[model samples]
Target: MQTSEYLTNFSAGIAPIPQDQWQALAQHCGPFLQYSFLNGLETCGCVGGTTGWQPHFITVHRHGTLVGAMPGYLKSDSYGEYVFDHSWANAYHHHGLNYYPKWISAVPFTPVTGPRMLIHPNADKQIIVEKLLEQAGRLEQFGASSCHLLFAQDFERHNACHAGYRARWSVQFQWHNYDYTDFDGFLSALTSRKRKDIRKSRQFLQASGICIERRGDGQIRPQDMAFFLSCYQQTYLKRSGHTGYLNQEFFEHLLKTLKNRLMLVIARQGDVPVASALFLYDDKGLYGRYWGSLRDVNGLHFECCYFQGIEFAIENRIPLFNPGTQGEHKILRGFEPIYCCSLHRLFASEFDAAVGEFLDREAPVITNYYHQAHNVLPFNATFRAQLISSPENKKGHF
Candidate 1:
């Protein structure tokens, strides 16, 4: 597709684009959208191979100068994407249509919302968005059933919707920093019962002789990663019948390449690590990406995953914390409900119409669920009033 002086091109992999050029368009986005992170997934065998994700990154150039790009992948299954599309696949199956291969613009195994369409500050955003939609539509030529962009930012979702994509909504629990001075300051804003429960959970950890340590960037050692991987594998093996989706190599690559953006919170008993939580962040927000523990302690999970994250965010002045996808348990710990969006375009008109109808009916339910979750937030009446008075609440963005 052409946009004035620009032309769109699709690469078999992210490797074709120079790292500097790709990252230039990703300025101020997020770590997940960076060239090193997405390319690391491919180089480390996380996305390519049998992992069902095959890179097909899209880029736009003006007179051979890169201007915009999107992280695109050809999928063989709906396994890693948090956006569930199995029902749609089954519908396609019943109709004797193939849905194995579909196009998606998302970071592998990441649910945090950020910019999916990366355009240079100087580029024409409207033209870039039009080229993006045109490229997605061209997926039909490859026999793909649909193209999807998951966990897209608000503006990206709006542009995609205007481009004739159907919007699907989901809810994720996230913590917002409101200039709290410390962890106690945060808890004081919560209801008495919630404040007590959180205090008790942390006290329980302390009484159990568990101490938490935060390791950022170069502070994380190789041995620490080994221990964390053991916990990660054991947790997955116990929960599911197999190991987790990521491998030690993938994490090692992450540590080596994106170490500066990494945060590792370790729960230890007198220098012996028992649990670990790995987080990633940029200037905008912190993402609680993964966590695991060797032994089950009464309150260790909440301490390592939720409380420590809150404390870190408070101390660091990070405004947002996404502690992963689902957990009603987060509501009690001060995570508020926020709407996450994904856009879809099915190649088949019949399936497209059907899925659009399904989304049209489902969107209201998701919105209602988001509202219902607010009722269960642990914020006290006074704090809730302040929150409701904020501009974000008025806009319904949170």
Candidate 2:
């Protein structure tokens, strides 16, 4: 079974790697990158078959001992990844090239950023990165036109850039806890107008006879999950004319395997659930993943998704809240703009150069948008003064 002293192997699925061993190497990574989460996607049929995501997990071993791994998929279409490449695909089509089958290293349907290259703490990072890039380059043999590492960590993105991948930039809104005491304390830092607007939203929900309940771990029952899934599918159907990317089995598996890390916020009117927001968290932060409503009440979406997540983070002492992607609306609700990057390597040289030129032209615009968005943050003068006075502010950490 042993091939070489140092071997890099790509599995058709993650089933080959032992869960405990793989998890040990992935220490400190987020729940999305965990063994259970990725495996659930495969086992529940959310990823395989006609879903267009085929697991192609990469693993590195030395003397038959696992040292490095990455969650990878052979994607037939650019559907779930938040890093949009449909334009690139169109460009390929205009050039009379194929771009359908591509390789991506990311958590399917999850846009939150973390480590794409999962390396053991004691492993040589540079060597692992080299082996990974080598394997990515070999995707051409499998009829893949490109390899994308989406929503990668800063270090991994930099490494990929050094290894000659084109860097793509995007922005997401996230709320940070600056030692706030509670939800009211969080609002105190916001501008007067924003504070009033938020208060009005909450008042609308309150006056509608809607009661918000936060359920986590042991409190989240099977009925709650079923209700959440119904709402999730209904929302997706209304928006996309189809059900969601995830199925009930996928969510049920997540609930069973990642119970403690999962949190659900249910909005009820006189003992009947009307809406729900699902979140995943660790000690570091909370991530708002999915939300849907059986009934529409004014300002209900904002209260269920953003405000509830903020309250939960504050009460639990979690530092940050990433309320999913792409909304200028979140900025006014106290979520600040955060920069995220992805890396890509196209197999065709001519297409690669063209895409590189496009990215070069696009980078400055994205940077400018981020800066503009930062100026519009709703923080009051006192909070702005506090941020300016902090040492981390000097380094532009946020």
Candidate 3:
């Protein structure tokens, strides 16, 4: 396989690949290796240089056929990445070491778990690993601290390990779907207390005159996008020193290219949209991506992000809802803790070992935590028995 390095230029010959090619590749590679969803990030300038998500994508071909590809970035600052390495950066600063510019292979501003490497089904995994490793070596000359692969898939784990990268584990909460007839069927599976609690949380919006509505690209008006963007910005502004990476162009692209897979759930008060949550879906699963509320209404967050998503999944027969990363709040609401893994290849031996040790220590705690959390599901003995006894229900339990 011949490897080529494409620098982070948005308008170069190596422009955004066509959606058909991406979908074909993703189909050959599998569902999570989506092209339309990923390339949309570049075409819309969401992952461009201005956003500190400069693309340094890697492509490998054999006999003039695309064999393997990796969507990577020359990241200046780590903002949207879920793998928190701020402590490592601070440690580097204390030791007078440079750590800002690093290499990361991930979906920018997205923390959903999926494949990082796109390899043809017949491609040699070892060869792919070697080429990717060689690419990581380039970062050292550029004074990068490390090359990290965040939220990688299970198959990529072995190859990354062979490439001498350390593995780290993180947790995110997700709701699994069973063959429920309706929302009540789902609610019936929960304990009485939990069932009532979720019902009450959703009902609270009624008092605020905030009604939930589903709007797609066709149904969305211009003002609707403006309101959605406003709420999205508010989510970042509340946190000090935060800047949003995406712009109106990105949302516009999503409307154009991914309208069928997109759903914008809005919370409205007297015909005014106050809060909205954006979700991406396929036939199998629903991904709850970005969401924010204009007004801080109690229980609105759960209703808009979780309950609404669950209801949608139940109605549409989508099997799972991944509501971003790192929230214990979603646990009691029937979201189970799922493990997300990442692989890192640090340039420095000392730092590499340090991170390896850190992950070693962290993994056990995460494992035990998941076990403890698994016990906290709001389902009673009967519901639990039914859920466990049924293979389909068990599959949806995440």
Candidate 4:
């Protein structure tokens, strides 16, 4: 398809694409691009401007058939995006420019990396990307200083780099499920000290009389949500000046509709709930979304958020656990440095060139950082191999 005919802006003409095509796109692109998943983000009201997320989704059609789509936004501020550009915003401010109302293509709030440019099966990805750039070229009219595509897949990341999207890399700790028949098999691969430490952590949770429960869908009571929010609030308060981006309704809606894909790990003491971690999963992996605790307990966060999720993944056979982003702490718990990707398209030539140069300088540092983080893994080479080996993880399957 010619790029022009293939592209259309839907700022005011946003129409619901048929479910079949949406699912087909996801299946063709694989699980991370699932329709139910993206649609759920919209249906839950998380992506609309009422919550500071304004969807400006872009689509491509070939011969009147849906072929590609990019879930984008006219972001007024940079809150939900895991990739940070506050420096650029600051620079723009110092130069008397406004950086708000920029364009972004990403999954809101969730930073787990997969596909960002949703391409249909057999579609010309190059054309899709060109059309995207063409639309992004017009970002200045929307008062956007630049357009950013976060956590794009490797191919799209490279393509964007070549097409003038400055590339930036960040390290996120991810637990890859090696083929382990069970949790014990996983622990057996750890070094004696790390293994013992994890075991003792679990023991402490038990000794503290903490009971962990997994709740899904309608089974999540109002009290569960309330407790989770309390823990979540406490997390922000600890950070002085931290303001939460979401409200209770968001979780309520997620629990109601995305339940099968939602997993809530709640820790309770006697009759009181203390800590909770919220995770979302599909066929490919488990995404640990939020974790909060009202009271501090030694190793409690580790046990609840990392270890328990790993056990669950092993039991259910989920392949990976992206326990949120930016956690060096996760590395000690067996998470590896997986590079999350993003792309940028600045509108003004001089600004674009400047940002492009800035990204070139930054990308290597980001790359080197991930490489350095890799050397700090908690296991010996042999144990690391066992942890990454497929059969070891599938055996314990979540």
Best by lDDT: 2
In the range 1-398, model 3's lDDT, one tens digit per residue, is 33343121212212555455445446644233566656667777787757778777666666555556677887888888979999888888898998878888888878877777776677776676677567667777767789888998887788889778899888888888867788898888888999998888767779779889987535766566677888988886786445367777878777776677777888988887789988888877788888877888898888888888888899888888898788788888888888888989878889889888988898899889888888787777887777678666545452
**Which candidate do you rate higher for TM-score, 1 or 4?**
1
Pull out the clashing pairs in model 3.
none
The candidate that achieves the highest TM-score relative to the unseen native structure? 2
lDDT, candidate 2, 1-398, per-residue tens:
23345698898777788988789876589888888988898899989899999999888888777888878999989998999889989988898989979999999999999999888887787787777778778889999999999999988888888888999999999998887899999999998998999998898888889999999855899999999999999999999998898899999998898999999999998889999999999999899999999998999999999999999999999989999999999988988888898999998999899899999999999999998898888889988888878976643633
* lDDT values for all models: 0.87, 0.89, 0.76, 0.75
Residue 336 lDDT, candidate 3, scale 0-100: 83
Ranking by TM-score: 2, 1, 3, 4
lDDT of 4 by residue, 201-256 (tens): 88888999898898753467767777888788688778644636556666776666
Who is ahead in lDDT, 2 or 4? 2
For model 4, give the 10-residue run with minimal summed lDDT.
389-398
| Candidate 1 lDDT by residue in tens digits, 193-256 | 9889888878888988999999885688888888888888899899987788888898898888
Candidate 2: misplaced stretches above 4 Å? 1-4, 392-398
lDDT accuracy of residue 28 in candidate 3: 42
Q: After superposition, how far is residue 75 of candidate 3 from its true place, in Å?
A: 1.5
| RMSD each, Å | 1.8, 2.0, 3.4, 3.8
**Model 4, which residues run further than 4 Å from truth?**
1-7, 12-20, 27-45, 216-223, 237-243, 384-398
Q: Model 4's lDDT to the true fold? A: 0.75
How many clashing pairs does model 1 include?
Answer: 0
Please give the distance, in angstroms, between residue 72's alpha carbon in candidate 4 and its true position after superposition: 0.7
How well does candidate 2 match the true structure in TM-score terms?
A: 0.97
